[model samples]
Target chain A: MRSTLLIAWTVLIEAIRRREVYAIVVISTLLIGAVATTRFFELQGLGKFYREIALQIMTIATNLTVIIIASRQLPREFESRTIYPLLAKPVSRLSFMLGKLIGVMAAGTFCFLLFMLVFLAGCQYLKIFVSPPLFAQFLFLQILGLLVVATLSFMLSLMTNLDAAITLGSLFYLLSSIFLSALSYLYQFSDTAVKFILRVMVFSVPQMSLFDLSEKVVHQEVWPPVPAFVIGQLTAYSLAFSSLFFLVAFLLFRRRPL
Target chain B: MNNSSAPLIEVRNLVVEYASRGGAMRAVNDVSFTVLPGECIGFIGPNGAGKSTTMKVLLGFMFPKSGSVKLFNREPGATEARRRLGYLPEVTLYYPFMKAKELLFLYGGLQGMTRTQLKVRIPKLLEEVGLAGRGDTLLKNFSKGMQQRVGIAQAIIADPELLILDELSSGLDPVGRHDLRDVMLELKKAGRTIFFSSHELSEVETLCDRVIMINKGRVVLESPVAELMKPLNLFEIDFEQDGQPQTRSVSGAEKFNATLAEIISSGGRVIGTRTATRSLEDYFIEIIRGHEGSGR
Candidate 1:
């Protein structure tokens, strides 16, 4: 476990030190800064409008960062031949995978925290009345959502190349709401075989929308903070999907020749 | 339990293959050898001759198509086995974002060294590998030779019992190689096992206890360094006899001594005596040439 953390620390340090990650932070700050100062069409101060756009940007940017970071972990290791020296230590393949996943998650969380700060400053400028409990729940669900993305990216990275993994992972995260809706819409007109395939897709592909609390937070007048039972259900649901993806990734990686 | 008498690394009739476009390419074929504790063995071969392939199998980076490999009586790549070993890869590009000190700590920490231990040892290791006072520098700014030095620092950080170095002096300049040789000599004095492959045959001649020469995925010669050097030396007798300069070449020690005595008795003064020894590179090429088309 110590070895695992040590590996994760290296990844985290890289994520923190690499100039590109800071590029994301700078771009995100500018985007949020623009949104905060935007005139609300003809009106003066529409806090919800600014907050909604700000939150969406954070979600999209953070999720994309997570996918990009997670997907490249294995490919970069193999490409640079860095895996030889790393695995040369007492670390196991399983630990290596876990470390990468944890590191991606930690880096993603770091990215999100920076986004959150930017977002809060934007909210302060717009005088947006943020609900403490709803915001906390939103943060919790977003992290769980990020974990699912990280693990899925890990599995995809092993199954394909870096570009394809990032492309697929980002597409899945970006289009998840449409995907869930499309499945239900397609289920009506499909033949038996197509319906069977759709059913398999439903069972296999995680509903990224289920983890999204953005709508609830964006339209705060409609919903309050979620109950504990639902939060528990979301936690279990996310873990089940993450474990399935992680297990598939581990099966593929354990005996692989480095 | 690891028995002290057992071979540190053992391989039997090992074969390894890689998937090429046409089919499986056999990279190592029916190779077998053992490395005992406290021995510095040099694995020398040409490009594409399966030296790296065999090392990969021994390190558990790849699975062999057939036969067996064991390190410390445990299966290859066993975590327990790896903990007792250190490895320097053929291409040594480490985490470039990390400072040299942090990278050493990372490798050492993974192998179960405490931070206190690393903090104390990393400075000394950097100095030993000729990187003193450069511990805080990030690896990206380091030259290829400097990165190779960092690779060496990481490999020996935890001070494992066995060290496996591939292309030991790959990017080192003369001074860097000289420093590395000194460090390796010190390790040898401390009695650590080293198994390495190098295109640099002179390094092998200077450091190896035994040399294993391979060609076309097979080992052609494996012998103790002392015995191999015995027949390779050419003794020369230089003398002035009867107001004439003369030079005589002899093969065996007895003939050389006899020639020397005969020259001395014939009213002669010996000018100088020299022994021209055959280099390992010459011997390697000859053996490799002989082994061509000998593979079954």
Candidate 2:
């Protein structure tokens, strides 16, 4: 595990050295600064307007980072055939894929933290006493969301070209998390067979809504510890998604002509 | 276990196919060959004649549709098999963003080498491939020939027992080709088996001990350079006969002199007499054309 993390770190350093990660960092920083300057406003009883904006911005940034970075890993390898030399070594395909996943996740996580820091600093500059716990929950949700996006993108990259993979992966993430949230209401009123199918679909796509503590964070409400059920489900979903992606990558890459 | 005489690389009835847009195309068909230690065998063929396909199968880039390839007694994709073999593809594509030194280090590290090991070996390889002073340059900026040299360096970095090079001389000028030929010879002298494919028949004729010619996914000929180029005894006699000037062929021991005399005796006056001269290149072309014309 330690060695895998070290390889991840090596990948990160290489990414940063090439200015790819650095470019995203710069862009995320600019977005944070831009969002923090929006005029003061209010949104119903749900949350403070600025805090809501902050959460949304961080989520979008996390999504962009994953889409942009993870999608590039395998496609670039395919184009350059660099994977040949790498695979020719003692490393397994799983290790290479996992290393790529880690590299992308680390980059996303780093950007998430940076955006949070900038957002909080902006709040402080405006004399808004943003509680530490509020920021913490926002970051937790952002990281989890980014994890899903990274895993999905990594998987899609194995089967499709870079741009299409990113687009389809981002769509899958958005639809699975947001659009699929409506299935519960349908299950509550639908016929027995339809309800069972809806339930299965809900269970299959990640219940990202459960992990989104952003609403609670923005409201400055007392935050509950992430439920073990939700955490377990998310973990399983992430693994299943990543495994599916890797399996496809393995099947496709094994037969790749190079 | 002292089977020192066993072939360094053994392939039996290897078959490889690819699903093309038109349909499934057989790239290699019942192709079987072996490389003895210290032998530099050249695989020569026209474009798309299964040269690269066979090499890819040997390197584990593509799995064979049928048959078996055993390198060092291990399957092609097995880690143990790869560790003992080196490969250079026709196109040497590297991570454009990485400098030469970093690229080498990353690949070496992937092979489970320590930093110290890479540091010790990279410089010598760099110098050998004429990239000694340009280690810090991004691979993207290097010219095609320079990149090919670096590609060769990486393949031989581990001093592999078997080196599979696909079109090694591509993009190299005559001088560069000569220099690389010398390097290959040096490696062969060190007891390494160099299995390379090339369309340049002359280079194959000059460097290879035995040459395998493939046409349309089939091996047409596999013979030693000396034997492939052995002079054919058929004589061509041109003379002006009763009708119009015609050519006649003679057989047996008298074929040569009889043809010569026939031309002179017919008052045709042996205008010209030529014996079949077969070079390796001509033989390669002839066989390829022969097979291709037969619609094989």
Candidate 3:
């Protein structure tokens, strides 16, 4: 565990030096500024409009940053031959994978929190009111969603090249967010064989939309009447799927001829 | 276990293959060797001769398709086995953003060293490798030779029992190579088991107790350096009057002595007489040429 954390810390330090993180931050700030100056803000319910836009930007920034970082972590190491020295140590392949996962999570969480601070500052400038509990729950769920995406990206990276991993990771995120719920409706009307395939596909991909509480937070819904229970379930779901992806990645990585 | 009694490294019939467009390509074929404690073995081979591939298997960076490899009587990837081993790769690629001290600390931490240990050891190692005050500089700014120095430092920071260095003298200037030779000699005195691969046969001849030569993914020769350096059935005798040097191809020591006496008695004034011995480079080339001729 200590070795894993040491690798994670090293990776986190390396990630912070990457220009991509700064680029994302700058783009998020610019987008927030553009949205604040929009003529739509002059209309009524300005707070909801601003919150919705700000949350969307945060979601996109966090998810994109996670996918890019997680997807390229292992591939870059292998391309540069840095993995040789690291794996040549006393660290196990499983620990190496876990350390990478933790590093991606840490970096993604930091970026999300930074973007959230920017969004909150933008809200303050626009005189938008955000309930603390709703904002906290939304932040928690956003991080959970990012974890799922990062884990999927890591797994894809181990199985394929960088471009393919990132492409498949983005596709997975988009499909899970937009069409995962619609799978239930499609399944009800489908034939038996098609239904089985649909069920398998749905089960294989994570239901990322479940962790997207942006709509609820924008409208201040805080679903299920018990935010703590929802948080627990989301945590469990993320851990379960992340573990599966990490296991598969470990198996592939151990067999890889570095 | 008694460290002196046990072989530090043992490889048995190791076979490693890779997939090619045509078919499976064997990188290492049925190679076996052992290194006892306090012994320095030099692994020499031409390009693509599986020297690096075999080192990778021992370092656990790659798995063998068949056969067994053990370090310190444990599996290669076992934590206990690796803890006692240190490796310097052929190309040491470190993260460019990290400073030399940070890189050493990272590797040291992975080896389970504490903060205090690293604080004392990092500077000492950097100094030992001739990079004393450059620890705060980022690796990207360092030259290739400087980076190689850092690679050596990191490899020895933990004072491992077994040091596996690939192409140890690569990218070093003449002075740097001389310093590395001194360091290696010091390590050998400290009872460290050193198994290094190199194209510098002179350095190997100077430092190693045994030489293992590989060609086309197979071990063509393995012998003690003394035995390989033994004189063959040829002699060269030079006279004091600067006459033409005479060369003799004799079958036995008695014939060589008789020829020497005959030349001296004839008032030839024998200045110097020596038997012809083959250097490691010549032997290596001859073995490789034979393998190529056999088309194996």
True contacts kept of 2: 0.43
> Residues B1-296, candidate 3, lDDT per residue (tens digit)?
13457898999999999899999899999999999998899999998999999999897777899999998898887889889988888877788889999999999999999999999999989988999899999888988888888888888889999999999998999988998999999999898989999999999999998999988888889999889888787877766543765555555788878987887787677767777888999998888877875542
Give the lDDT of residue A232 in candidate 1. Answer: 100
Separate clash counts for every candidate: 0, 0, 0
Off by over 4 Å in 1: A41-45, A190-196, B1-4, B231-233, B237-271, B293-296
Compose the digit string of candidate 1's lDDT tens values, residues A43-159.
233667776777888888899999999999999999988899888888889998999888889999999998888888777766777888888999999999999999999999999
Per-residue alpha-carbon lDDT of model 2 for B1-296, expressed as tens digits? 12366786788999888889998888889998887877889998889888888877877778888999987767877877777777787776776777898777776666666789999989988888778888999888998888888788888888888888888888887877887888888897787888899877788877888888887788888888878776677767777676577777655547678667656775775557667667887777677777776543
Q: After superposition, how far is residue B183 of candidate 1 from its true place, in Å?
A: 0.7
Q: Is candidate 2 or candidate 3 better by lDDT?
A: 3
DockQ of each: 0.74, 0.34, 0.66
Q: Please give me the DockQ of candidate 1 compared with the native complex.
A: 0.74
Q: Which stretches of candidate 3 lie over 4 Å from their true place?
A: A181-196, A221-226, B1-4, B230-276
Q: Which candidate tops lDDT?
A: 1
Q: Candidate 3, clashing residue pairs?
A: none
lDDT of 2 by residue, A1-258 (tens): 433554566557555667655676567667656655665544233136666676676676667767878888888877776666666665666677778778877877776766667777767765665566545655665576667677677767877789899788777766766668578667778999998898788767765565577677666656555666666666666667556656766677655676
